[model samples]
Each structure stands twice: as structure tokens, then as C-alpha cells.
Target chain A: MTSRRAFLQRSGLIGLGFVAADALATSERLLAAVPGLDPGDPEVPNEEVARILKDLFGDRPIRKGHLTLDMPVVAEDGRIVPVIIESDLPMTPEHYVKAVHLIVDHNPDPHLAAYHLTPAIGSVAIQTRIKMKRTTWVRAIVDTSGGDVWAAYAHVNVSLNGCG
Target chain B: MAIGEARIRIPDRITRGDLITVNAIVMHPMDTGFFRTAEGKPIPAFFIRDVVVTYGGEQVARFEWTSGVSKDPVVSFTLKADKEAPLAITWTDTKGGVYRQTADIAFTAA
Candidate 1:
């Protein structure tokens, strides 16, 4: 364990130790509370999103607004589903987007990615392609530096599943 | 080291307060490390972890990503333009590879 910690430290990922430890603690606590939870699965269950939200924001409610998630109504390939997320929030120092998250409803791993942001980003828009396991709802959530959370969602119809 | 391509799109004639869309794609395998080669050896994971776009020496957008992104990653976003400027995009990969591309925008009287 010390060697692993040293390796991670040498890799310059020491700042991520808190997040890694939090995720591990959250998963362990969740497994103890939920029955039949698979330990091998890396994807956070859809039901666990609430727990994650609670963990991230204690008692702060997340509202569905202020974001536009552009996604294809029907995706020809599940391997590549293009998505664009734009936020209407101001990028001023007082109110800037801090982070964004991509979540899939039915994938083995629901939490696809998390993006940290800074005020240097003048616009709160992002575009990328994500792999979908099947036809499911995908969501984009944004957290602003001013302590506000906004989100939007879209449904993609996939012809075939792609994630393992 | 691999070569990456990027493109910036704006109206032929830029007027103040016009929204300009920029699209960029990088040539990368984006190996997820979940697949095995024919010899059954697992391929190491390497992908672009961060991409940043700058215009007029100011950052316009930035993206933080992971292996979940598709191969040959493409990103598009819009910026409200007030003046003509050169746009630059830089991508940093997980394997310590840095790629950059730039394009200039010409403003026409509107």
C-alpha cells in the first residue's frame, strides 16, 4: 500500500487522493447498505446518483435548468454519440462554472466523465463524444463557483449497444 | 508523436456579437486499455485528457476528459466574437503528448 501511494505521488496525482478516497469510502458505505451490489462493477448505479449528489453537495438542491444539452435524437452508432453542453450561466469571477459531469442512465458505468473548470474559460460550452451501452438517457450537470447546480438531459436512441 | 488536425469556423463576415463555432478533431487511437491485441496482450490506455482553446491570447474554452471519450476525438463550441483574432487549440494526452493547431479569422465590414 505504501508503494502504491508512493507511485501515485510520484505520478503527480496526489491532489486526486481525496477524491479517490472519497469514492472508495462512498462505494464501501453504499455496498454495506445495499444488498446484492456487485463489487466488480465500476459503473455507479443509477440509483446511486442521488447518493453521489448528496455526497458532493450536502443539503444543496440541484435544479434542472440553465443548461442546454444538444444530442442526436437517434444515434446511428452506439460507439460514438456526439454531445454538446452549453450553460447560460455567466463566466465572471463571481459566477463561473466550476465543473461538469456526464452521466448515462443504463451503462455499466454510469458516470462517464467529470471536467474541472476555471474562470479562464470564458464560455461554459463543451462538446465531445461518449460511448453508450444502449438506448438510454444521458445527463449533463454543471456546478458553478457561486454555489449553484444546473442540469439538463437528453435521450439517445442507439441502434446497438457499445460499452462492455 | 502523432499529428492532429483542427478547424475553426466563423461567419464569412464577422460582426460584433456574432457567435462563432469552432470544431476540432485530433488523430488519436484513444486506446482505452480494455482491449487486447491479437497476441492477447492488453493495450495500454492513452487518450487526450485535456483540450484548451484560446483566442486573442485569452482562453475561450477548456475540456477535461477521460478514456471514455471516443477515438479521434472531436470537440465543438461557440464563442461570441467581437473582433477578428487567431484561434489556437492545444490538446494534452495521457501519454504526455501535446498537440496544437491554430487558425486565423478575417473580419469583413458588416
Candidate 2:
């Protein structure tokens, strides 16, 4: 009969093996999506968000106009704050909104989400619920495939932090 | 049984030029890995990372999200409908789980 201690030892080793394998597989898929994403780092800091945006958009100034962002001014729970973004920019083959980068200023990972849009949609509007670490500014930066960037910002007051 | 339940909402009928809102919600834990359970074990992070919406075989919205999104996320987007077609919504979690749902849409006059 196998001793209890021996069984525990074998199970512990098997658990470790499974964890290591899972990490390896996850990193491989994440690398393909975010090349610079670090395997050791689970979340990107606020400073990292700025760097990522700068790298993606270059030095172009993102003007705040022609975009509408809707979100409640106050949220009782920061865990599920509804947000909506609408762009008046025309969607055409020559000129269209390429993507929308949603960033929360105070979240542990400020780079909250991103959405890629196409002209086939005939419109550029997206809505999603995001979690906030605290009361912060959620900004949406819209990239118009034509070397122009537009942004819209909304402040959400959270009574309770969500990312703890 | 699947780990999540996904539902997609599309308008019953809309004008050709009208913008219709499509909403999708998936029930998920969205654990951020920063919290420790009562047993002191940190829950592994799990969340839906990619959301793809396709209409009439044309991809419209592609969203990438992380654990920063809330539990049971609600994703809504609008598209101008020129013709009636089927809409496909798919959500891919971090663990390679894919949940997909399709809806047939028909448009009416303005």
C-alpha cells in the first residue's frame, strides 16, 4: 500500500508539472498577440500604457473631437462600469477608424481594452463594461487609418475599488 | 456543461439606414490573480481575451481585453445594417475556451 506521505509527494510533483506546462503554453500564445508582453509580468503598469500608446501611434497628437463617450459620472461599484464610445468619423475604404484604444488612468493595468474596427461595419461604436482599480479617467483613443488620432475622455467616480 | 453562458441580443427589425445595437454577455469569473482565497491560494487569472463579431461573413468588431474587465462582461456595439444577414459573436478566454453564438437578422423599411 502507498503511504500517505508518499502519495502527497507524488501529487505535489504532478501539480508542479501541470503548472509549468500551462505557463509555457500560455506564454507562447500571449507572445503572438503582445510581442513585448513579459511572461513574468501579469499586468502592465500605468507608465507602460503610455509607452505602448506612443509606440503604436508615434508622436502624433491625439485631438479630442468628433468622438462621443458615454459613462456614468458616479458608479457605486467599480467592478462593472458601463462605457460606450461612438465616432462620427466616416467609415470608408480610404478613410476609416482603424482601432479604439481604451485606457484607464488608475487601474493596475491601465491599458484596459482595445477594439479594431473595419469599414465593413458601416459604423464605429463600441460598448463594454470595465473594472477600475479606483476612481479614474477612462480615455478612448481612436485611430483614423489616415495618420490622425482622436480621443474622448470620461471620468468615473468609484466608491469601491475593484482591482484589489 | 460549459463554464460560461453567452447570450447575444439583436434588434427584431430595423430600417436599412438605422444603426442597430448588438449586445453580448458572458458569465465569467474574470479572476485577476491578485486575490487570495481563504485557503491562501491565489486563483489563476482567467478572463475572456478576444471578442469577434461578424455580420454577413464580414468581420465588424474585434475586441481584445484582459482581466481588467469585470465579471460577466457585457459587450455592446452598433452597426449600420444595409441588408439582413446572420451575426456571429465569439468570445475566446485566456484558457483557449471559445464560446460562440449566432443570430439571424432581418431588416424592415424605415
Q: What TM-score fits each model?
A: 0.70, 0.78
Interface RMSD of each: 2.9, 1.3
Off by over 4 Å in 1: A1-58, A72-76, A90-96, A105-111, A114-125, A157-159, B1-3
B1-110, model 1: which lDDT tens digit per residue?
A: 35555455555666766666667788887776766889999888887888887878887666777666788887766666665778788889987889888877667676
Residue-by-residue lDDT tens digits, candidate 2, A86-110: 9889998899998988888778778
CA-only RMSD, every prediction: 13.1, 13.8
Docking class of 1: acceptable
Span of 10 residues, lowest total lDDT, candidate 2 chain B: B1-10
- Which parts of model 2 are misplaced by more than 4 Å? A1-46
